[model samples]
Target chain A: MEKRVTVLAGDGIGKEVTDAAVVVLEAVAKKYGHMFRFDHQLVGGAAVDAKNNPLPEETVASCEASDAILLGAVGGPKWDHNPPALRAEQGLLRLRKQFDLFANLRPVKAVSTLIQSSPLKEDIAKDVDMMIVRELTGGVYFGTPSLYNDEEAVDTMPYSRPEIERIVDKAFEIAMKRNKRITSVDKANVLATSRLWRQIVDEKKAQYPEVEVRHQLVDSVAMSIITSPKDFDVILTENMFGDILSDEASVITGSLGLLPSASIRSDGFGMYEPVHGTAPEIAGQNIANPAAAILSAAMMLTYSFDMLEEAQAIEDAVYGTFEDGYFTGDLTKDQPLGTKEWTEKVLQRLQA
Target chain B: MEKRVTVLAGDGIGKEVTDAAVVVLEAVAKKYGHMFRFDHQLVGGAAVDAKNNPLPEETVASCEASDAILLGAVGGPKWDHNPPALRAEQGLLRLRKQFDLFANLRPVKAVSTLIQSSPLKEDIAKDVDMMIVRELTGGVYFGTPSLYNDEEAVDTMPYSRPEIERIVDKAFEIAMKRNKRITSVDKANVLATSRLWRQIVDEKKAQYPEVEVRHQLVDSVAMSIITSPKDFDVILTENMFGDILSDEASVITGSLGLLPSASIRSDGFGMYEPVHGTAPEIAGQNIANPAAAILSAAMMLTYSFDMLEEAQAIEDAVYGTFEDGYFTGDLTKDQPLGTKEWTEKVLQRLQA
Candidate 1:
């Protein structure tokens, strides 16, 4: 099998991490007897500096020609003063819009080695492994007539049946691959959009009869996320609720630097990235954790290339490195490994 | 001093808990040398059973004539089959609408003795004494043209300057009373209403120069509530965000039975109630916890009547009772006190 991947090493620590992911992916390709071609593209702050555009046309063309895209991180304080269109983060947003990447998958799994660092008690955070499927493109953030003046402001939350159906279908498909349970979250009693969201979930469930479904109010789910996170399998929510909840779920793992996310469309085309952002202060230090970036490559393998075993191998190797007491600067104060050294350890474990 | 208190012991354990609160209020009245008159009224399922209305006209009249209202939990499975207007919870919603109770106050404090019961680790859960002031009457919950059909649904989130100003002022006032710091939560970068909300907070800061203020995104605040709850003093947000966050904050303490809430207008006229709902299964039993109802009365003393010292006395006594190992069934399983017995213990501590 062969795959062409676009590598967007945006700026700062993004360069370090994406370089690390490419090395890991090369090792995986060698071991699995697959042809993996990498196309490097400048984006975000780097693109803005060199080409005066946050998302350059050549970069988009390379991404359009690739099977999957792996991004490290985007934006920095240097570009913070730029106008909205020129902002570094706008590059990633535009890419998502261009690809119609409507479903965002954020998987929060409490690593046993990092459980003590979690804010939640060990007993509560120990077995929390859930996937949050968020509809990325629709809802309040993009709803029209969202205008404001000195006296008043109004933002709309709009959801059509087709939009709700596609996301719900994605959640159901993800649920079938995991624990076969989906918790559809919304404020059905109050918001018409939520009611429509719930209705779509109910209609879609008939198609996936083997997968169990439960409807929960957003508020109730928020409480349960902390108290009984183990009860959820796949949490499906609209844009705004998903934005809040996915972020909330990320913290329970304690190691933000170890989390990976994917934004994909129906055809399994995806852009994978680490949940952490660009660490400008630690950019060239060779000290930033690359676990999340490597795992994001793993997600790309599974979701975009349909290489489940290769994905699992990468995931296990990453976790095994932590289990073997290899620490990154973000996760420990004692004897931390450099980005290159940590990827080396993961590679040794992957080959072992 | 003289005061008229309207008590609505709506349904289930609402009757028992409200009865316990009355005993505590009577004791406080005697000790403080205040003339207190109590007017009892029906408002929820009980109102539906007796008067064929969830909120009877007479109940409204009684509430209007009173200086402040103390309500028990409302709603029960028995009324779940009723039409929307006839539902038991509608009574409470109508009351808030009737009084224009724009501000909903939910205070979350980690009690020392019960800290072990929290889902959060002891260090994270300890010192979590924050007040959440929510704008109740506006935002998406009650926005106009919240229409849904087979194809699409739309809900608006609208906030006028005056609406934001009043809620921000209330939050500032509450901040001045407590820690003199406020964390205003919004999604200003995306939502137009949130941008206006942030603007209002900035404008209102001039009037509250002594109170320190910080702006936070709603998603960041949600994570912070669990990661570093002690960092917040007053968390002010719009209706839907507040609903999700207050509920999230509630679970960290692990003692939902002890939490109290208040909905108030600008003039300090308010309705106080326990955050817990009507536990119909436990109704007419002596096992219900009345700590929340008793605390609601304390909130009434401070907010509605401006009896700060008297409010402190009630608060201290309740905590003192718990510290002395007098456990209610909700807080403990071994040798738990009955509803009446717990109230007696609180009363004994108050008198001491």
Candidate 2:
């Protein structure tokens, strides 16, 4: 297999974690007889410092030319005071829009040893393993006539049949790959968009009769997610609800640092990244966890490159490391391993 | 003090629980030397059965003429197949719109004895006592140009400066009345409505200089609420965000049956109700917990009637019952007291 990857190691600890991720990715490539060309690019504060643009044109060109993108993290206090247009965070948003990434996949799984660290009781947190499929680039966030002034403001939440069908179909596809159950979440009782969304979901269900479907009101599901997280297989929701529920699900695992996310277009092109932000305070400390970033690389391999076995190998290595009681500081109150040490352990496990 | 109270004991457990609430209310009136006139009215499935209207014109008129209203619950299996207009839940919406009830106040407190019942660990769920103030009758749920068909759909989330200000002011006032810290939730980075909402919250903070205010993006706050629930004093957000967060907060307490809510107009006219729905399965059974409904009557005393001492009496009595190891079935796995017996216990504690 041959793949070209764009690595946007944005700023602060992003550099450290992405470095760790690349090392693991190279190790995987060596273990699997594959060729991967790494294209290092400037983004966020680094890009602004170099070319006065948060998302340099050259970087986008490189990404467009690549098979997939692996982003470390973006933004820091260095560009916090910058105007909205020039802000480092805007670079990432522009990149997503530029690629037309429409579906965001967040997989949350409770680690067996880390269940004690969860805010939820062991009985509740231990059994939670679910994926949240969020519709990106549509609905209220991007709806037209979103006007705001000193007097009034408006944000439209619009969705067409095609938009709903694609996301619903994506969810069904993903669910078929995993647990074969889909919990389509919406505010059907209130929002017009939700009513149409439910209609589309029902239509999609008829096509994929093997995949069981359940429609839940957003409010009820929000509570249900917490009350009975293990009950869910694949949670499908619109943009705003997804933004809220994905973040909510992130905390459920008790290990936000280990979570990986993928944003992909209708085709195979995708961007993978760790769910956490740049920890400037911990930059250069070598203690930040690189598991999420590494797992993101694994996601890109499976989701973009069709390397399922290779991806599962990385996942197993990461899980096996935790099983052996090797963890980063975030996972435990006891002494923890540095980024290099953790990566080495995972690499050693991958070889075995 | 003399006041007219409209009691809408809608259907199923609504009748049982409201009966329990009225008994507590009459007891409070006897103890506090207040004159109270009760006007009972039909609503929900019962109203649909009698007058063939979910919210009858006479019921609306009675509610309009009263100083405040105490509602039990609404909706049941009997009216599940009715048309949208005649549906049992529509009656509640009509009443809220009729009263122009814009500010929704839901106070969530994790009971000390029932902390073990929560899905959250004791450390996380024990200290949770926060109030969520939601801006109802606005935002995407009621926004105009909300159209839907098989092809496409749209729901606008429009907010005027006045709409934001009133809700912000209401939150600040409520914060001043309780702990003087407010966490205003919005999605300012992406949503235009949130940006305007943040602007209004900032401007309102200038008026209540003593009330410390913090702006949180809705997604981050949703996670933080579960992670550090004790940190919140007052959680104020727009309609949909509030609907989700308030329900999320409700389950954090572990005893949803013990929570109460208020929907108020600017001038203190409000309707009080238990946060739990009418439990049709347990409707005629004497096992329903009346703690939430009784506490709702307490909210009416303080918020609508301005009888703080009387309200405190009801709250303290309920807490006292729990402290004495008196458990409702919803609160514990042990043998539990019936609704009437629990009401008698609360009344006994009030007189003591």
Candidate 3:
């Protein structure tokens, strides 16, 4: 089968990394005897400069038409001065809204070769691997009644039953794919939103008898992730909780550059991106790690196209690339390799 | 001068642990040559069993009359099924409202004796002695307009200028007391509540000229705390963020059973409590760790009454008790020290 992939080489190191990932993906397709058509698109700061719109209609159109969208990084100092509506981040946010990509799947796994890169004790970072399936679209971030008045301001955390049901179902389904334990993180002990969240999870638990659902207040879960991330398999949290927890999980693995995520909608449309932002300061220097972007390609193949074997091959190549102790500047362990060297190394591993 | 301390020894190991704290506090009074009188009050499930109300009118009156309040633990299976108004947790909630304790100071320190409890590698957990000065009263946790309409629900995160000002001011003040760096954690990129929180923090930062203030969105900070906790000195965040961050901070030490918190108001009144809950499963079994309760008393001495030396003494005693490779069943680290054994060891260290 032929897969139409839309590639958003966002800005700064984004273009470099995405280019690197595309080459790897192209190689994977040829090696696997599958056809993959790649469409390049503009987004974030790059799009802002080109068409005065971070997320132009053309980009969205291309993304919607494709089976999957692969993104590098977005936003830089150039777009920082832009208004929120026209900013590079807006492009990323708009895509999430347009695609109805409610579930954000961020997987943090420490490659054995890069275990020493982390500041954490080798014991903790060595065994640390978790999948944070965050609700991408709504919660306090996008809930209604969000207003700023003269004296007081209020942001509402509104959850429709359908919204809760869909996300919970997505989390449960994802949990089934990985380890069978699903830790549903919320603030049920205090917030009414949490009460509803817990209620829905309780209602949904019986449907997936194989997955053991543990309800933890968001705060406790946050601590648990840092203290005992090994105890968890799949963490399902609200938008804000997911955002915070996913980042925390990234740090545990010791490199924001190696982390990858998939923002997916129910119809299998997804935008794969690295969790890191565009580091414009290091852009031209070619010091940024491209592994996250490369790994995101792996996720895109698996989640968006259901190409498990191909995805695993990409993952294996990524690990294999670093097995001999080579990595980008962001790797920051004992010996740091430049971006070009790491990218070439990963590609070499793939060919081998 | 005389001090009136209201002691609410709620349930389970609460009474036993609080008793140990009471002994230490008495020792503190004697060492400091101060008059400290304790009026023990009922709360949590104990209050419901005795006066049929968690925060009884009489208890509230006594609490109102006290200089500061020391809580042991609240809630268990005993009051888990009770309505919100009658639940054991409600008692603590009511007290926070009554006292208007807007600043919840949770100090997370990896105790030298119990470093083995953390799931994180010792290197990562080593320098993680930071204070999470969370805005205890505002944001999504207590936001009104929170409702469950069977099919859907909404929770309002309302923050007034005063609420933001007080919490931010409190956080800065605490930062002045500890490290010179303050990381104000919020979701200013998204939430209006965070906008106000950031606005207030920006305003208040001007007054504390000596302290360096850094802003981090809630999501980023959540991940950062795990990956790079040592970099942070004072972390100031909103209620929901704090609730999660403080718990995450607790795990840096590897054991939630070893942390304690203080909820204080501007006028110097505060409630000291263990950051952990009443573990009813191990209640009356003499296996529960009394270390957290003891540490809370130490915090009460330092933060509440300015008895720094006495607080240091208690902390030293705790470190000494654990240093000898002796610990409670909850610690499960080096040696097997039951509740009584742990308490006795600390007492010996205190008297030494």
Candidate 4:
């Protein structure tokens, strides 16, 4: 199998982490007897510096032609002074719009070695392993009539049947592949969008009869996420709720820097990236952790390329690195390793 | 000073808990040399049964004529089959709108003795004592054009300058009285209403120069509530964000049954209630905890009546009840006492 991945090493630690991911992907390709190609494209702050635009037309074209996209991180204080339209983060939002990436998958697992690092009690936080599937394209963030007239402001949170259907179907499909329970979260007791969402989910339940489904109010889900995180297998929500909940879930794990996320359209195309932001402070330090970016590549292998064995191998190597007493500064209870050293340890485990 | 409080013991454990609150309030009045009057009224399912209305006109009139309102839990399974207009919870919503209660205060404190009750580790959850001030009347929930046309549904989250100013001022005023910091939560990066919200908060900051203000996106606050709850002093947010966050804050304490909340209008008129809902399953069991209801009375004394010493006395006695090896059925790590027995213990501590 051959895959072309557009690598957008945007700014700061973005370049360092993307480089680490590429190295890990090369090892996976060699070990699994596969052909892989990489296209380096400028985006975010790097693009603004080179092309005077956060997202160049050429970069978007390259990503469009690639089988998958791997983004490291984007934006920093240097670009913070820029106008909102020209800000580096706007480029990523535009990219999502270009691809119409409607579904965002964030898998938050409490890492065994770092369980003690979690803010939640060990008994409450330890067994949490769930996938949060969020509807990205439609919702309050992009809905019509969203503006302020100096005195008052209005933003619409709207959802159509088709939008709800596609996201709900994705959640069910993913739930069937893993655990059989899907928790559909919304404010059905109040919001019309949530009522429509619940209606569509109910209609789709007929098809996946074997899968168990439960509907939770958004407020209740927020509370439950902290109290009974172990009860969740797959959490399906709209854009804003997901934005809040996925981040909440990450914080509870106490391993925010090591989490990866994937945003994909209806088709198999996806752009994977670490959940962390560009750390301008650590850009050239060579001490940034690369595990999240590497794990994101693993997600791409499983989700986009259907290379389950290769994905599992990479995941095993990541778990092995931590178990073998290797740690990045962020995850260390003892000795800390640099990006290159951590990548080397993961690579050795992958080959074994 | 003399005060009249309209007491609406709505449904299920409402009667049991409100009865306990009255006993506690009476004890406080006698000890503190104040005259207190209680006016009983029917509401929720009980009102529905007797008057064919969830919130009878008589109930509203009684609340309007009183200096303040103290309500127990509302709604139960008995009213589950009722039409939307006749639902038990509507009574509470109608009352809030009737009084134009715009500011909601939910104080979530991690009880030191019940530190083990929280889902978060003792180190993270031990010192959490934050007040969440929510804008209740305005936002997406009640904003105009909140409807569905089968294909698409929309709810507008609109905020006027006055709404923002009032809530921000309330938060700052409360912050000045407690800790000197306020964290205003919004989605300014994404939502237009939030941008306006930030603008108003900034304008109001000049008046309360003594209070340090910080801005955080709602998503970040959700995560931080779980990761670093002890860092928060006051959290100010709009309706929907507050609805979600207050519940999330409640769960982290693992004492949802023991938390009290207050919804206040501009002119010092307010309604105090337990954060817990009526448990129909345990309605007549006498096993429900009365701590939250008793604490709600404490809030009424401090917030509406301005009887600080009386409020402190009630608060201390409640805490003393917990500290002196008396445990209610719900909060018991060892011995469990019934509601009546727990109320007697609290009363005994109050008189001591």
The candidate scoring highest on lDDT is 1
Q: What is the C-alpha lDDT of each candidate?
A: 0.93, 0.90, 0.82, 0.90
* Interface RMSD per candidate: 0.6, 0.6, 1.7, 1.0
lDDT of 3 by residue, A1-352 (tens): 6999899989888988888888889889888988988899999888988999999999988987899999988887777888887789889988888889999999888788777666566776776778888888878889878888656788988888788888899888878878889989887767777788889999999999999999887767776666556788889888877887887777776666678899998867788989887888888777788888899999988778888899998998888877777777666566777777787888788888
Look at candidate 2 and give me any clashing residue pairs.
Answer: none
Interface RMSD score of candidate 3:
1.7
Off by over 4 Å in 2: none
lDDT of 3 by residue, B274-297 (tens): 977887777787777888888888
DockQ of each: 0.92, 0.88, 0.68, 0.86
DockQ winner between candidates 2 and 4:
2
Q: In DockQ terms, which candidate is top? A: 1
Summarize candidate 2's per-residue lDDT along A228-319 as a digit string, tens digits: 99999999999999999999989986988889999987787999999999998998899999999999998898788888888999999998
DockQ of 2: 0.88
How do the residues A1-352 of candidate 1 rate in per-residue lDDT, one tens digit apiece? Answer: 9999999999889999999999999999999999999999999999999999999999999999999999999999999999988899999999999999999999998888888998988998987899999999999999988999999999999999889888888899889878999999999989999988988898888999999999999999999999999898999999999999998898886876799999999989999999999999999889999999999999899878989899999999998998889988889898999999999999999898
TM-score of chain B of 4: 0.97
Indicate the worst ten consecutive residues by lDDT in candidate 4 chain A: A325-334
Q: Candidate 2 A-chain TM?
A: 0.97
Question: How do the candidates rank by DockQ, highest first?
Answer: 1, 2, 4, 3
Candidate 1 per-residue lDDT, tens place, B1-352, comes to 8999999999999999999999999999999999889999999999999998989999999989999999998899999999888899999989999999999999998898999999999999987899999999999999988999999999999999999999999999999889999999999999999999999999999998999999999999989998999999999999999999999999998788899999999999999999998999988889999999999999999999999999999999998898888888888888999999999999998888
